[model samples]
Target: MKTSLYNIFSWIRFTFLFVAVLMIWALRTLNWIWMRPNRLEKCLRKQGLNGNSYRLTIGVTKESAMIIKEAASKPITFSHDISARVLPSVHNAIKRYGKNCFMWIGTAPRIHITDPTLAKDVFSKYDDFQKYYKTNNPLVKLFIGGVISYEGKKWAKHRSIMNPAFHLDRLKHMLPAFHSSCSDMIRKWEKMVPEMESFELDVWPQFEALTADVISRTAFGSSYGQGTNIFELLKEQSHLTLQAMDSAIYIPGSRFLPTKWNKRMKEIHEQVQASIRSMVNARVEEMMDGGETNEDLLGVLLRYNLKETQQNGVGMTVDDVIAESKLFYFAGQETTSGLLTWTMIVLSKHHEWQDRAREEIFQVFGDRKPDYEGLSRLKIVTMIINEVLRLYPPVVELTRIVREETKLGELTIPAGVSIMVPTILIHNDHEIWGEDACEFNPERFSEGVSKATKGQVTFFPFGWGPRICIAQNFALLEVKMALALILPRFCFDLSPSYAHAPYVVITLQPQFGAHLTIHKIKH
Candidate 1:
């Protein structure tokens, strides 16, 4: 009788476990479907926000894809006014619905925040929001691998070790490196010019080379010359990644499926890794030889990581060092170059500001090479660069995914919803900057960006808060140094061949190239 009772109890326990497993599976499937369309609409509606009704499982995916396709098909223009060009869909949605509205991007509801106060709130709670959107292409992951992809504890650890490398004092020490790189550019341009006549030239490549040189000198020190081929391969990889990104469907294991592009990308990645590893190995060997210290960024990073590793008995591995070095190589090269290219394009259109900036550069340095102190004193130049960043930000958009149920403003964002903050839209919002928001007016920055945004977090070319670009100062100093040298020595105007096609790969870049007419300034 006791054995019979035990058997019955065991059967009951088995049935209960089976029912719980079934319930969990059912809930997960329902969550995936509802989370995209139904739940997103309900959450927005609860907050008095209106937008297109989510359509079943597809949500807004079709509409978002259509917009991207259309943008890609159009011919590139030379206008720096991206807000005017790119705002039709977003503005139409806002016009149809209220200011606070949601739009669909591939079964994901994108909530648009035009209110400065609300934008501030979103940026303030950055940690709660992460950049892991559902549709992130695997190719993109391969290209932009580093601290940018990390969140929470991992992000904290990487950021802590990397922060000291970009401090202002270190950037100041790197000013000569910035100047040397710019001087190489100026010399190259000087050799290219035939007589005093204005000649049309593509400035994009020049900017690219300048930034590459700066990154090489500043980040790797003596190791840069050896790593040139690695930079070239990385640039090729960037182009391939963009091509992969344009395709919609990504099957499982597609990146390693032995396709032509995949093979090429793999080869490029390996070459870059090998180059970085060689440099790192050399540095380690040098450290072993009599403890001679190298003060460059790479050396500083290696030493710091080594010391930390020794103390903690575990820190960033050699592979970590290689990953980060590649990241710096690409990110540092692309960002500053893009910034300078756009700034040059904008300045060419506004020659008065160009002359004014030149005058300021002259007053600050007077034909002498720009130093850290002199670069800071050029407030007008700073304003011009800041204004250019607002109009043609290098990073046009930033995405954040909700890891948990989080409250943003009055809305409860369910986990897995990706929030995209379009920097261009926010920077050029008429409500925030008044009627002249779209115009390139450096005077807006006269009272400083804080006052300009009325204490809201509106202008974020380098982002805001803790996760802001680590190399903001480095990029700025490089720009100031380059402009201070170039503007005084040459007068430039937009080339007729210039096509103003700004698009995003890893960073926002000219789809064609920045063509400008350059005439040497008579000293």
Candidate 2:
């Protein structure tokens, strides 16, 4: 009878413990989905920031996704005012809630910062407002989770190791690789076009291929074939990443599920990693044997990486090097491709700018290969590229998180709120940029970025402050080389089949394609 009583008591205790665990979980979830968001909402509202009250269901994430999809379905007329199509949801939010407002991305409130002073502050204070990589989809973490995703010490370490490769002197060594790739692409175009007739070709895919080839040559040198293969995998991986980020609703352990998209993404990730590792191992072996490092990015990186490991005794592992290489392929390829594609489209629209740029190219190089010094001297080409970047900046917005309570201008932002630095919006704001903000006038940047932004932190195509893109000079130099070669050889105008739909898939791209009538120039 005593034993039976003890068993009954044990069972009752177990039941009580289970119920307590269930209750705790329920409360935490309730806080996450409802109470916390509401509290953040109240905090922002109290600070005079306006926004729609946070909804417990999905917040505004689902609604914003739907709005973006609807906006991207149709093509906009040929005009430089692309913010409406590119960032429809954010654009509408700014219109409805004013510039000093917040929008919900899941439970988190993203505070829109339009003021240049506040933008500058947020950028300068990198530690306080660090990158927010918290995401629902794991694929995003797999692809872009490198130095760009890191903070504090790790970011500094990686940045230091990789900085030498992008130095102007090192980049000059890679100029030959750039020239070779551009020549190959232009040669292909020459073959396609008849003696003097125009050919309706898509420059978007053409530029994509050209940039990929350039990255292959400039990144891996002798391993160009392997580099090419890796980027092809990365390109597909980029698409799958966009699809994986379909909604904000995240189920715990959902990434482990054997969904088709998830499986393919994992496969591609492994393939890319293995490919990069193979190259790194081979290079390391060669380096240990006292082989001279080539001039490509890999050589410079490995050489610097060795120096770092020897001096600091703590350096990037093979895996770390692989991540940086992937970044080089992804960022280097995508940024230059987008910049060149847009420059062509914009120049085509405004033929006068094209004439001016071509004239400058001639005066600087005169049918000769464009050297770095001459490329730098091409002021008109520089202005056109800057204008293109301002109108269609590679990254539309920069996200930073407030892990602790932060102060921005007059507002005291609570912890867990996001800061949205919408570069596209600021770039196109008439109040800051005068009435013709949306128009594609390269003369706005005639003097330079400083004069264009009037010393404000408004024109950040590659970004601003310490965390600015490391490869900015590398990319601009390549673009100049391509233009220097092509501008004097051929002239292009938009094909009637072209649809002017600028949208973001990781970066801004033409929704349809950049179809143009390529006419060989008789010089």
Cα RMSD for candidates in order: 4.4, 1.2
Kindly list the per-residue Cα lDDT of model 1 for residues 1-523, writing each as its tens digit. 9999999999999999999999998898677566546867787788787888766555355565566657755645555567534544675676678666878765567777776666666666778887653445675666667787787777777888888899898888998888887887898888887667777888988898888888888888853466679778988988888666545445667666877887888788888888889988899889978577677888888888877788877667788888888899998989999999998989899999999999998898895778888999999999999999998887776767777888887778877676667788888878878798889899999988888877778899988877889988899889999999999989999888887777666688877888999999877
lDDT for residue 237 in candidate 2, whole number 0-100: 86
* Model 1 score (lDDT): 0.80
Model 2, residue 234: displacement in angstroms? 0.9
TM-score of each model, in listed order: 0.89, 0.98
Give the TM-score (vs. native) of candidate 2.
Answer: 0.98
- The true-structure Cα RMSD of candidate 1 reads 4.4
Off by over 4 Å in 1: 1-36, 56-62, 75-78, 84-92, 133-139, 223-225, 243-250
Judged by lDDT, which candidate is best?
2
Clashing pairs in 1: 61-106, 77-500, 78-500, 130-400, 130-401
lDDT of 2 by residue, 5-84 (tens): 99999999999999999999999999998999998888899989998878875747889888999999999889999988
